[model samples]
Target: MTAEQINDKIELCESAMDLILSEGSFTIAQLSEATGKTASQIYSLFPNKKAITEYYYPSLVIRYSAMIGEIEDFESYTISEKLSNFIFTTFDMMEDRREFVEDTFEKMVFKKGCNSEFHQEMTALFKHFFTTDGRIAVSAGFVMKDYFYEFIAREYLDIVKFWLNDDSDGKERSFALTDKLTGFVEEVVYNKVIDKGFDLAKYLISHAGLAKNIPLFGEWITSWFNDNEEENKDE
Candidate 1:
């Protein structure tokens, strides 16, 4: 599409999003009436209400990224602080559209093939912070980096869901919860890479209840020991 076409599509989607917020729902005909555009024109851009709702995800991500990117000291903030800022900024942006978000979340989030794009967008956002000082890179290499990103993406959505239902004073509880979760992830990665005092694999196995259900657990443990014995012989 040409630049002008792209701009028009964005404007239409923004208008539709506003309508969704104001009315708690919207149809293409309503959007056409509101925007002075034909129903066919709106349909050409978004085939259904769900598509318009899904448009908010990428649009909001871009807006949030640009907003945070403009902060002069954003890069200087620690990972947890950056995360807190992201969560707060996102909530601020969505404050006016809370109902629309909650209504469309089930329809858009975790759908078979829909989440991966959003996940990638979030991963790219977090990777900027994670790679700032090469902290995440220390423990997360080629094999583990994708998993780390996926975990952060999934946790971010989970936290947003929790935040929507939070009713504590000034929503301070959500901020505190986000801080704890980010801190825990940092500590786990730090111990896994820097301290090495805790064995994450062993901890996972121990906490994985119903050993019989996980047939690979025994084979994994045996292989771990065999590898250790081989290393000992090499030493």
Candidate 2:
């Protein structure tokens, strides 16, 4: 599409969004009246009112990226600080439009195949962290793999949704919760709880009889017994 065409679509979507924000609900006719466009024109641009709101998601992501990109000292900030700023920035931007966002989210839940786009947008947002020199950051012996990105994205979305319903002064409750959850994940990753916990889970599952027919269960059981024997020997 041409830049002019894209700009026109964005303008139309923004007009539709404004209608949603003001009325807490909007129809294509309302949007047409607001934008001084024919209903057919609006329909050509967006199949339905919900699509206009869906368009807002990607626009928000772009605006969010630009907003954060302009931060003067972002690179100097710690991971927690960056994350906190990101969360609060989102809240700040959505403060006036929360109703529309909540409405769109509800519609998304009931609409098949719509949630994946939301997840993808979330994944993109979460990936802004751990980026150095325009690349994903890596530690001495660790890397932020795809699954890690997916996990953090989902967690971030969950926290944002919680924050929408949070009824605290200045959203202090959501801020505290975000901090605690971020710290908890850091602790788990740094302490190797993830690896050890998975090992323990496998051991438990092996003995739970659910894995009796699985070929790997026998070896897992043997390894568990051997490890216990070695520990006893050392003691």
Candidate 3:
């Protein structure tokens, strides 16, 4: 495709994502109609629905992050509350379109050998958040390390997945779980590390090493618990 055509198609795909967020779902035919192109044209650009999903996935995040930034600046909001609100509100805003996000998360981020610009962006985003003034107080002797930020980003994906699958208590279970985990980490940082004379940055980096992989481990344990619960029901 010509560069202009490719750009146009990208815009069309973005528009499709917007519609899906607003109206639940849209077919290639619908996208084509909206873009004043033929269905074949849409397919030529995206190849298939999965390609569309992949294209739309990062775009969705970029948009959501912009929206989150707007509400994130109120003095009344605690950092933890701000972060949680961003997560939940973005999820709610996603509505039925979250399947795409979940799919992208699993296939692109979590799966082995699935690394890309997307994964790096996520890691960097977390690192940036943690090193900033609102995050942890930087010291003159402190080195800007990214270890914990990477871990948090990886864990955040797992948390989102947990929230998505949880139908219990209107997904309050997932929300509560995330809040507890965040607070636990915060406490660990403040009392156990900061107040206790540990190197706070280094401690966070160490915690990152342990916590980043815990999501995958947590998944296994959750599965085991679910299986045992089912076995009990059967017996």
Candidate 4:
């Protein structure tokens, strides 16, 4: 969608969320009134209440992207800092709509599974800042080849779950949780931890002789190991 269309949808979603919170249910007419837009206008963006909520978390990602996109120096942030900005800004975005999130949590997560889209999109956004992995993928290999970003997306949802339960003052503990986790992950992933894990996995797989049984995943692992070694040789 064009940026304008996305923004209109986001506004409509915001109206739906507020209406849901205050009135305990949402309808197209209600959203139209809330947004000061006609029912047809609202329909054009969000056909139904479910679509609005479905777009909620993903919209937050876009909001973060837009927010950071404004900062003149955001591109200069370190990998960890970029991650921190993303996570912290997301929390801030949800803080005002915490009730909407709490009420819709099970529906959005358990039902629709937002992580598949949210984190993958966020990973693509991070692609702009996490240039090391991108560069490696171009020359050496795909450092985060397959399910790597998917795993990060899962981890992010786990963290969001943790944040929701956080009762500390302004969620100070959870913010600290984000900071510590991202710092550690950046140091590890950007520091060849994946390659190290590959070496260990290759050793284990060799000793176990899984080469005869499991073909797909085992070969994926072996292929990445081989590719990384080839890149090192070139270096």
Candidate 5:
């Protein structure tokens, strides 16, 4: 990429954020001002504000994934702590770009549910967490599916909404509640399965206990039970 291309990209993003927050729309002139770049330079990088927004979603996903990857790397940290810290770090990353992050998160969580790209990424991460640190937990018997997302969203909706509204409280409640619920899940998953060594997976497989229709917009919802031998490998 040209130096102007490389340089203006960040500015375009910052400007888009500032304009959206200050005014409800992101414009070329606003982005140019925010990034201290000439209009011609910006035009060369981005055709228009809509292009910036389009790029923002995928870029946001990549950035968010990296943040979650950090939480995943902390082997000593419990799942609950990692989750809490993840939420905190996430908000921090979106400090000035709060509106976009909140809107994207809410849309993925409640509106479109898991149909959105963000939710798909999150579900993949959760699946990875289970196969890794949570492997024993899963093998032992913690087979709850859809309820997990519902539980998390329900647990933090108000705090998240409040934080989006003002963010003056520094997201204290959101942090605390996320930590608490994650702890609860950790206990339910770890203590119940790892410590006790319950054969819940067997029951789940033999009986299809965790079966439910996953919400797919136009596609058939499928369940990923431990017994599905075909789904044992990566997709």
Candidate 6:
């Protein structure tokens, strides 16, 4: 959707949130009254309550994306730094609207209320973060990106759930969790470190002839050794 359309939908969500806070969850008639739109018009805007739920995160994601765009050196930031920024920025945005967020998040996402479209959007955004420009050059970038995307999506939801329940002063504990979690992920995903680790493990396993004792990967490792030997012979 175009920028204008996204803004419009976010505005609609904002209005719905106001109604929700005052009168508890929304009905079509309540939405109509809130937006000065008739029942039919409201239907055209939000086919059902779930549509409102669906639009919420994309609005947040779009806003986060825009916020990072204004950072002149965002491209220079490490994955850990970027992620820390993301969690903190998201929490900052949610601070004033914590009640609104809790009301919608529990009903919409926390209770398994998301749909395929929401997952798809989240996947796409995570893909952009992990693979965009020169951000993260994993050894097998394309091959492993979808797995990374899944990790990020799951992690994000888990963090949101943590935030919702956090009672620490200003949610400091949640911020600490973000720092530690993202730092660990950065070490694993940076450049070819993970690939090099796997390579070293394979070599050690083969060198010690220990693949036979390795159970699940024993046969595969034996074949892997044979293939490498054959390739060396051909050279």
The top-ranked prediction according to TM-score is 4
Worst 10 residues of 2 by lDDT: 133-142
> What's the CA RMSD for each of the models?
9.3, 10.1, 14.8, 8.2, 10.1, 6.3
Which has the greatest lDDT? 4
Q: At residue 18, give the lDDT of candidate 5.
A: 66
lDDT of 5: 0.56
Greater lDDT among 3 and 4 belongs to 4
Q: Which stretches of candidate 1 lie over 4 Å from their true place?
A: 1-10, 27-47, 110-116, 135-137, 140-144, 189-235
Report the C-alpha lDDT of model 3 over 109-179, residue by residue, as the tens digit: 56632254444665665454444535443231133346565566667667777877888977889889889
- Residue ranges of candidate 6 with Cα displaced over 4 Å: 25-40, 111-118, 133-137, 140-143, 194-235
**Ten consecutive residues with minimal summed lDDT in candidate 3?**
135-144
lDDT of 6 at 117: 48
User: Higher-TM-score candidate among 2 and 3?
Assistant: 2
What tens digits encode model 2's per-residue C-alpha lDDT throughout 1-235?
5656555567777887787677767887787777788888777777777677777756655567767768998777666666677777777767767777777654562232225565676566666565442322223124466667677767777787788788999888999999988776555434554456446546655676544555786557556656755755885
How would you encode candidate 5's per-residue C-alpha lDDT over 55-162 as one tens digit per residue? 554344356555555554575666676556656655676665766766665653446654544455555555455555643465433364655654454444444555
TM-score of each: 0.68, 0.63, 0.58, 0.73, 0.55, 0.72
* Candidate 5 total steric clashes: 0
As a whole number from 0 to 100, the lDDT of residue 114 in candidate 2 is 24
Backbone clashes for every candidate come to 0, 0, 0, 0, 0, 0
lDDT ranking, high to low: 4, 6, 1, 2, 3, 5
Off by over 4 Å in 4: 110-116, 132-142, 192-235
User: Between which residue pairs do clashes occur in model 3?
Assistant: none
Q: Name the regions of candidate 2 deviating beyond 4 angstroms.
A: 1-10, 27-45, 109-114, 133-143, 184-235
